[model samples]
Target: MTRPVGYYVHHQGAGHWQRAVAVARALETLGRPCTLMGTLAGLDTAAAPGPVLDLPDDRLDAGFDGRDGAAERPECLHYAPLGHPGIRARMGRIAAWAAQHDPALMIVDVSAEVALLARLLSVPSLVVRLSGTRTDRPHLEAFRAASRLLAPFPEALDGGAVPDWVRAKTLYGGFLGTAPATAATDEDGRIVVVFGRGGEGGALGPLVQAAAAVPGRDWHVLGPVSGTGAIPANLHLHGWVAEVRPHLASAALVVGGAGDGLVTAVAALGRRFLCLPEPRAYAEQEAKADALERLGAAIVHRGWPDAPAWPGLVARGLALDPGIVRSLAEPDALARTAAAIEAMCREAG
Candidate 1:
């Protein structure tokens, strides 16, 4: 019997969750039955589209922040070390779930334990990556264990010293965000206040201050919002939009943390953005923002930069005419990635 396919994303950041939704939504469109399996957070992402099997995330964020939060800094990344008996028990339950579900193709996003579960279930599993891979021995072992690896970046960039599995799966143009929505043209040139949903303290407050300093620009926040003071008559608190690409397309500039989804979305839009790499428990975002700056995709603003340089930087980036930053939702991205998976399934059969 052919099993249904599923996408598994570890619930860490919103990026993996976004990809899980996009891919699952596309599979549904293709008349293919697939389940999204992961922690409650990841399952919640797929809820809007279809069904999911909620499992636990080993990378689960506890109260700990990144290295900066500690004295003498034991670890730079905010990782909740697994191996607690609870994690082992959860892993066992997850393996049992996979045995019950028996998905034909398990497309795992950066999760070792999930990949291991797929292996235990005797199901063919594929790996999908966005940014860089883990250099650690365990991470490399996890990537190598997958049947196939896929890097969802344009082939033109970052072709390098990654292992053979990652290189084989690396394909370009996998912009995993919402397709470019029709910009609210009437509100063109407005400032987008991206109300970031981050656990990290000290980031959003300064962004709010810097935005307040700018005059005459319409400000719109994206997620959970709080704070007081005259939210300028021009500044609008748009709590959270269901789809932010339209707003990104319409805005003169977007102000937010260097979120992977936002980075990929804005870069795909080819818009001008000033990234405030939030000081957080983990510097993962800080690292991503730095990479983007080097790619000439965005400016790593120090919360705020000197006023004089802002306009010039925006002009230079915007003038590039990035056009529409298409995503997996587009037929092409789906067709390409799906084709790879389908071929693997057929071969397995």
Candidate 2:
């Protein structure tokens, strides 16, 4: 029997699952049977590259009666609330699945506790790299325990924050997304505003007002606009777009959070972009935006958008180096990464 590869997709948002799916597809192409386990709601395995295992929701793993934050066992991990059945069940499910399947390789995408669990289970594990300030004890412990660390972004985008020892065990796999059919050419002058879930804390109100102020431009808003009570006539609000590639492909300017999905999409399309990073657990979006800004790939606006400053930001975004942005479009990153993982599995088997 062919040994399977397992993936643990974090349920924080769609981005984690999306990345796992891309990698899983690549692994399937490499003739590896893959299984994805996650706590994400409404997970449809029909489109998955291989079998799917649905784990109990970890977010619901809070038994704290009126406690403000999550309950943790100790200083080594985070967010595993005490006496939370969901958390216990989720961890039990993962441990049980690993034991029954005996997967050759386990990929955590990512959680410190899961990576640690994989190592403790005697399974060689790869922990997916995350951006932001990750110097905490839990993060370091997880990274140390993993067999290898896979960073989904290009090596060029690496910020010097990762300790040398951790960097030694890491592999930079460029931006991993479902590669577009063909490289999308630059769009016309239509502007597309994508405010991902993180945008809830952003300046959506000002962004809409700014788009309205900029006349003679078509603006399409994608995803929820948190504070904007009324939709403007000039802007078409699309709650959620199933396939955002075409809109991104034809966009003149793409405004969105610095999440992996939006940034990678814009990079692939070679669109001029302004990154509005929202607060995250470890400054994830902020760090990514900073890197892109340093590369001249994106215009990072740290402050909330105001109508008065909108025009200038747009101008700055336009002036950014298109070549730099386009360089981030790694069409073959997933393929290379999958091939590497397959090789690792083969060696382990």
Candidate 3:
């Protein structure tokens, strides 16, 4: 009998779920049954290749935060709030699922606690590693517990900071997302600005100023934004769109944070990128931006530059080499990731 593989998708960002679906579909093609488990509220799970398990939300109630149970949290754990029924229920559900399925492998999109839990349950887990300085106790322990680590970007972007042991235990799956198709020609010299849901949206004031500064190029803003004042004639706000690929494909240059999803998409599409990395936990985006700039794949800035600086920045972004960015997109990444998981499952059996 072919034992099923279990994937625990993190609910914080769309990237986790996006990668999960892509990987699950690849696994299906390989004849490896897989199940995805996560807090599925507001997510479109219709395209998932296998059964979906919606887990309970483990966040604390309103008015309470992570600091509430900071002292009680174990040295090796990051988030474990006490007296939360949701947390208890969430872990209980995952434990129950493991007991029922006896899964050959558990793939954790990212959660130190959950990876540790799988280890406790005697299920070998493969953890999806994210970029950043993740050398803390909880992260190190989780990496050690994992049977293997999966880095979704090319190995060159790692910056060679991780310990020798982690590098040895990892499988570098370069950019696991939808491969880019031939992009439409950008006759209008459009500049597309994107903001992801994982963090605060872009500020409209700076965007307006930028658009006004660069009068020749039209700026199309996607996703949410804060602040409202005068709207620039050249700055068109579309808010959140159902699809961003069309806008991205027709853009002369792209501006956004250094998130895994946006970066992967830009790389795959061979678009020029102006990375304004937003602040994130463990300085994830900052670290990624550093690697991108170092590799000549993007033009990075610390923060939103003044209106006077926008013209030069825009020119620099447009001048970047699309071929360098496209090189980071491994066309066979999804297949390689799925094959690695299958091999690990076979070894376990």
Candidate 4:
């Protein structure tokens, strides 16, 4: 009998769950049923071909009574507030599920403590890699404990940021969740502005102003864009849409936060993008946006541009070749990732 694969998705953003679903689907195609445990909504249990466990939400803002009200975690761990029953219960649930299923491999995308817990429970695991400063003890410990590390970006763009030890165990999977680009009829210079679920939205005002200045062009905002400011006649707010890939494919220009999902999707579709990376916890988005700028896949902005700066930013973004963005998608990216996970399962069996 083929042993099932287990996936632990972090609930920080929609991106983690999105990536998890793709991975689970891939595993199912490989004939290895997967079990996903997470607090995220909208995940299709049916997509996994196995049980989908909706664990209790353990986020800091979940308003659990036991929160320490402080940002700092124990020195050894990344994040586990003191006396938080939710954290304990959350980990306990994962532990119980793993014990009962005895999965061949568990994939975490990702949490340092949970990755560490998987190893402690004598379960083989793989942890997904995030960009930015992750060389600290907690991150290093998690990397050391995992059976393998999965990097979602292209190998060509991987500078020496990841340590040699970690890199030796890492598999660069190019960009995941890259859907085939749909042939777009002329959008007539339509621009899509997306601010991910997380991140500051102060830039929305300037972007609205920019849309007003550019005549005959339509601007669409997707995801959580919070502001009480005036709306431009040419601007359309879609809020949170079920699908964003098609929008990216058809857009004349795309602007948004430099979240991993956003950047990778744009790269895959080969769209002209202006990336304004909001402040991320580990500076992950910042690092990604910088690499994209250097690679000519995107034009990175430090912040929302002033009135005068908007026109120039838009022009520069449009001037970039979308081909550079398309080059980041490797043909074997998704296959390689699925194969690695399958390899781990096979080895365990």
Off by over 4 Å in 2: 60-72, 181-183, 198-207, 226-232
| Candidate number with the higher TM-score (1 or 3) | 3
How far does residue 139 in candidate 4 sit from its true spot (Å)? 0.2
Clashes of each: 13, 0, 0, 0
Task: Name the candidate, 1 or 2, with the larger TM-score value.
Answer: 2
Query: Per-residue alpha-carbon lDDT of model 4 for 66-137, expressed as tens digits?
Result: 334677667657677777677888889988988888889989888888899999999999899887778888
> In terms of lDDT, which candidate is stronger, 1 or 2?
2
Candidate 1 local lDDT, 1-349, one digit each (tens)? 5556877766655667777776666666666667766665523452437766666444334753322232332222223353455466656776776678666688887566566667767877886654543555545655666787766554533424466656764454365555555543433777675644443322345445545566555667677665555554655666656677777777777667776677666766656666777664225566666666666556667565555555554555445333333221233764667666766767776
Q: In model 1, where do residues sit more than 4 Å from their true spots?
A: 41-48, 56-86, 157-165, 169-173, 181-187, 198-208, 278-291, 302-320, 323-331
After superposing candidate 3 on the true structure, give the runs of residues whose Cα lies further than 4 Å from its correct spot.
62-68, 181-187
Q: Pick the candidate with the highest TM-score.
A: 3
Give the higher-TM-score candidate: 2 or 3: 3
Reference-based lDDT, residue 120, model 2: 89
**Model 3 C-alpha lDDT per residue in residues 171-212, reported as the tens digit of each score:** 999999865544646536899999887767888888888999
RMSD of each: 4.8, 2.5, 1.7, 2.6
Model 2: how far is 173 from its true place, Å?
0.9
lDDT-better candidate, 2 vs 4: 2
lDDT of 2 by residue, 1-349 (tens): 8899999988765678778888999998888989999876754556688888898776643453323275436677865666678778988998999899899999999888899999989999999988888888989999999989998888777777889988899988888877764567656777888866434533457756877778667888787665656756677777766557777877778888888888878887788898888777788888888899888898888766777787788878778767788888777888889988988998898
Residue 258, candidate 2: alpha-carbon lDDT = 83
